[model samples]
Target: MILTGMIFQFNKDSGEGLIMSSKGATNEFSASNWIDTSCEPSVGLKVSFEGSDTLINIEVLKDESISIVSDNKKYSASDEQKMEEFSSVDEYIEHFKSLGYKLAKDTDDGKVRTASLRRFLEDGHGEMIITSIDSKITVKTMVNGKEVK
Candidate 1:
């Protein structure tokens, strides 16, 4: 059984991530101490806590909070093939997913085109704005209200 946890930093150097299994801090968090070899954990991912129940440091779980650790992840790459895949509207929808965006909701405002990601912002505060289609190979990131071209 492959263990799965929210992967933070992929230590290609060590071939592991700082996994926070169900048995958290009670177990040492050292690289040699990573207990599971499941799917590589993606930062900011909320997955199952797939270890046993036991915590070492009473407040140590705080260190394993994936979200808090993910806050510092400055960037991620999108699929180049999915950028300009607007051959059809359905393809356009799939393009969104390919670009690391989720299909939150689909509603017909009685229109031919869909208003993708009504509230698409990287953290709700608009810290990043990904304005690109599946057919384009370029991704422009907007940070602090400025476009980083």
Candidate 2:
């Protein structure tokens, strides 16, 4: 059976590692069992393996990229006018809150500020990420894992 998990522990000297499967089972693996030559074994790397006690045919899993589809609705003249009304990041966040979206994340560094808002959809979820850098603000939206511009 093929199982997916992350490499939680690895010892470079011994060429051995341990994988914690998504199902919570921990399995042992070694360099010989690894099948992917593109990358070396490391902790926290996602991988898939086939076996029970000792894993075999272990391979690293590649990250999936989200595809963005262009949708001009968010950039309509009325929307642009509304966006320009916000004088601060707080006001920008409040605008989305008024539309029933909830703040999912907020981060600020010395140079940049970012806020992520999310709302539940009938099928999946809708998310909007707003960023402010040097008094310039940009917005990106995604629905069901696909980004919509």
Candidate 3:
């Protein structure tokens, strides 16, 4: 069977490692089991191998890259692609919050503290404003604060 998992542990001196499969099983692999891979296995990198409990023919999985434009802009080509992917507002808000965003709070001046927070979200090119007022919540999704139309 072909199993996919992340390299849980790798001993560079020994060229042997253990892979923790998505099914939550760890299997040992050695350099001899390596088949077709250009890169060496490292801990936490996803890998594929064919085996049962004892994995063999281990190979590192390669990610297909999409060519993205690089420029001195707030949004990279990849960021723009991520911004356009939210099918709903909740998914959009959760993604940004996971990247470290606090709830929009009120300041001493009676103004919403969204200015600095706006920069936090905009830095990733996906603007997500979450407002909670008296138990009701509002989620505003935008690309740099202007709603995508």
Candidate 4:
């Protein structure tokens, strides 16, 4: 789920903080939960994030307008994209699962199927979600929080 909030309080030394959501709920967060660590967060900074109950993704909001403060290459979701053909949906899932990714979500209709898998790579981490219509499948990948085509 996505939630918008401002930093309620942060202890930079300990890398821990609380986010005060618009709904008046406060949730604890950690620096380690940040996907884009280029800009260290400060108290009172408005942020929108998505994550499970324990983890948070601040980039889905940061990338929309806020300029990142990193000196490293700007992470664009579309950079270095590639396309590959898969013989079947099972083939696609097996390919990524074999590489140590775990299935995150899977759904199917009579005519279409979809699945998402994720892995924390040693050098770069990524999520792969594939959708299949009949025998044709399209795969989308996000590496180090940037999407690849």
- Which stretches of model 3 miss by more than 4 angstroms? 62-149
- Evaluated at residue 145, the lDDT of candidate 3 is 42
Over 4 Å off in model 4, which ranges?
A: 1-84
Say which candidate scores most in lDDT: 2
- Model 2, CA-based lDDT: 0.67
**Cα lDDT tens digits for candidate 2, 1-149:** 66666676799999998776544456788999999999989976767678888789898754421111121123222332355456777887888777556776799997999998765422234557889999998887766446765
lDDT of 4 by residue, 27-109 (tens): 78988877766577776566767754664786334544334322223333333243346688778787777655567679998
How do these models rank on lDDT, best leading?
2, 4, 3, 1
Q: 83 in model 1: Cα distance from truth in Å?
A: 1.2
Q: What pairs collide in candidate 2?
A: none
Which is the better candidate, 1 or 4, if ranked by lDDT? 4
Which of candidates 3 and 4 is the stronger one according to lDDT?
4
Q: For model 4, what is the C-alpha lDDT against the true structure?
A: 0.63
Q: What is the C-alpha lDDT of each candidate?
A: 0.34, 0.67, 0.52, 0.63
How high a TM-score does candidate 3 get? 0.40
Candidate 2, residue 118: Cα displacement in angstroms equals: 0.6
Error of 4 at 134 (Å): 3.1
lDDT by residue (tens digit), candidate 1, 1-149: 12223333345565444433321211222344433355333333323333344311222223345443342322333333225624555565565554444443344443333333211222211112233344332334433344544
Tens digits of per-residue lDDT for model 3, 1-149:
56565665699899888765544455788877888658777766666678886777787654421112122134443443454445444554556555443333333333332321222211232345655444344555555346653
